[model samples]
Target: MGRTNLYIHYDAVTNHVMTRAINFEIQDFPKHYFPQNIILAESTLDFGRFDPQTNFKLIRGASEIQVYFESAHKEKMRISNWIDFETLEDMHGLTAQEIAEILYLFHANKALKSAFFYKLQNNYVYLTLPNGLNKVYYRHVQHFYPRFQRAMVVHMSELLNESRSLFFMRKAKVQALPLEIAEQVAPIFVNGLKVNFQQAYVKGSRHFVPLDIVEDELTLLTLDQAPKNHIGFIIYDSNAEKWSLELTLDRD
Candidate 1:
């Protein structure tokens, strides 16, 4: 979730969708810090039919709009493992112009200072209901998409601190998130720190460090609240040889 770079690709001709990610382990006390998306995953993620109810299910600040849509499960907020922005275009069959207009009207207002979608590679792609996952709305992501892909951007430490979706920085100020928002995250530690969501603990990261800090520069990533609980994580790792799911819990 910290300093993670997310890459999305949709082959318009072949109808293939891909999302690549490299997430940082906060326990490493990474020199850099960045924002974390509302993380989710599921198998056989579908590209169509995401029913978004902007009312009751809407979670501000911490949650993104895509999390409110329907995924594989019937639950309103249940999203499949992977996501693409095509559901809006597919479900309503709205033209690019209409969809753009709607978004503009909803977002382009006085109450909101500024609203923009972010994609890693393309910083200037004209995404008009961009088909599938190619449109995370970072804008211009498509312009450099080809370049970044060809190079295979594995590390994102060179990026500026402000444009942080996933990138590294030298020192950042850590902030505490509210309890309700903090508990939702199950943190991973690279140095073999055990985390259990079942326990009573506070968990949140210094998401998006602001520039112009006069205080001490952060060396290790700090959680707003570290939890004291017991819940094991099962992580699936894959390579050319074989795929493995790490960890097994002795349950209650």
Candidate 2:
């Protein structure tokens, strides 16, 4: 026989309560993924947008359930259940803001201490565990969801890593530019400066090195010393928001 799939039932009408099910093998699932089934059913009280409307009605009446996959590895799937709310209080008693808050808390509770929890920051709730472990919870506020919506979890890690790498490269390039220029310009002044030299040459000028000059000097040096992966530059003048080439340097 094939392995039996696990399931859980959420009763949205009953304080958004969840029904327990038999535990099964989910050990191989990735840390960032949450596997569960979501169902929407008919509720007479008109609980508003938080309650699944059209989709809920279709699934509740359908005999066959459809599972949709979503995740980094495309392994996540959703399961659905039928919901029934008999009283208006079950639907109308909670406002949209309240319903959203409840949902936020529910997801956060499940994601505590994981990368998924950190992604919740996009949803506008800062999740933190007091002990510095992987546990997380919502802040105490009147309406939390109004401030932040749910965050996209899968690409957040990639985006953050790329951002940090780009920032580091930019800073390193900026720092290297000035140093490269100074090295190139050093030879030009070395023989001529046989006379007295003072710290004022650096401290009193009040003129700092420009990045353009550094970049130009470095590019020329690289062409002369090392031809591998070398790049040349073309200088331009600004007109009415367009640049006219002042000079172009290409390898001979």
Candidate 3:
């Protein structure tokens, strides 16, 4: 025989309970499997007692639940469940404080301003400044293996002024390299390459050189690559201390 311990929290507003349990058993037994007997027993509870005055019927018992082992030596497991209710009004009231805190944080952070804009499109987010438009696209590329790509940028009017002269330049930057060689050697490229700007630029030419070409051009003037991409596009602005970047994709 094995020993087991369980802890449960009741949310009267949500009309549901969450439980966490720990158990010990011999090595031969499957480690964290919930026996059918326990589930069947729990199904018999009078869930309707948790709420009244509502017509909501508890058709199924704990249909959506997750259980996982937390520790092997201590034989700990965690379980979560979402009970269906007649109306979410009670649950909403219970979590209102937590929801308000999240909203407050979003307003305080500049990064979150673009959160609303990102939802306007399926996989693209657009940020508009006085001078130019920054567009972000969600893409996936394959080299040796599959990988996802996302981009964000601060477009400067000064750079656009010289767009025609730099439009045909070719250059490559190390985005990702073969896993084995990536550590030692970075990606390199030659000049005069033609590339498209993922972000839409209205005032300037539609096309711009690859970022690598821009870096090489700056290095020729400044005498070195700024060591990273961020430093290469610095511009002065009045509305905000720094330019805002928009998110191209929301993670799955």
Candidate 4:
């Protein structure tokens, strides 16, 4: 998950829309959702164009869900561009404007000590958090979906490391690393912990990292007898072809 975005979910049964300010995983839109967006773009002729983004019907309901397009407000909405952003919306009843205002002011005034809005750069507002962590947000285009004040945005930068570290390391298990490799590749180890402790044993410059070690009883085998993907298949000297493993699985 490179950079996350907030997602909006719609219920097709009653044409309801909702949004939450959480880091959303990026996924390919359903095959059917694409054409609905295209129709939205072509149908709305004059004035504000429909936003292909923002919302989609999550439930299939044994039938194709209709994608909705409408001018949220007769007038366009705009807010100071954000350094950390995602749009919140008002649908048939959701209060997006109130939420956006509250959040804008909340961060802009530095209401919270740990995280708050910091400064402005011409047309953009920057929110600063602890560490070197930061992301930039944009107002998207002029298109609007349902009802929204603005589309929040984030800047993709090396600072994502700061985000992963800050967000995931809470109550984290600590481990000391070599000083030389700290800044160079420390983050890689933390990312799935794919480090190869047996790199020295591999021939040449090849560094073979064990994918995942299933916590199971050890099994014994020689290097030649090892399967394509194996764990606990004991091995030591490749020159002498010495290896063994012991696997004990109990089924009752």
Off by over 4 Å in 4: 1-90, 101-205, 208-252
Better TM-score candidate (2, 4): 2
RMSD (Cα, Å) for all candidates, in order, is: 19.9, 25.0, 23.7, 20.7
lDDT tens digits by residue: candidate 4, 149-182 = 1221121121112244655554322222223322
Question: What is candidate 2's lDDT per residue for 164-217, written digit by digit as tens?
Answer: 455455321111112232233223221111101110011231211111122212
What number of clashing residue pairs does each candidate have, in the order they appear? 20, 2, 5, 21
Which of the predicted structures, 1 or 3, would earn the higher TM-score when compared with the native?
A: 1
Measured by C-alpha RMSD in angstroms, how accurate is candidate 2?
25.0
* Tens-digit per-residue lDDT, 1-252, candidate 3: 121111222222322222222122222122232221111111223332222332222222222221221232244321111122222443334344433432332333212222221111111111221211111111110110111111112123323333344566532222222233211111211221111232223423222211223322322322223333311111222223233222112211
In order, candidate lDDTs are 0.25, 0.23, 0.23, 0.24
Q: TM-score for all predictions?
A: 0.18, 0.17, 0.17, 0.17
Model 4's C-alpha root-mean-square deviation from the true structure amounts to: 20.7
Per-residue lDDT, model 3, residue 181, is 29
Off by over 4 Å in 2: 1-58, 61-89, 110-252
What TM-score should be assigned to candidate 3?
0.17
Q: How high is the lDDT of residue 93 in model 1?
A: 51
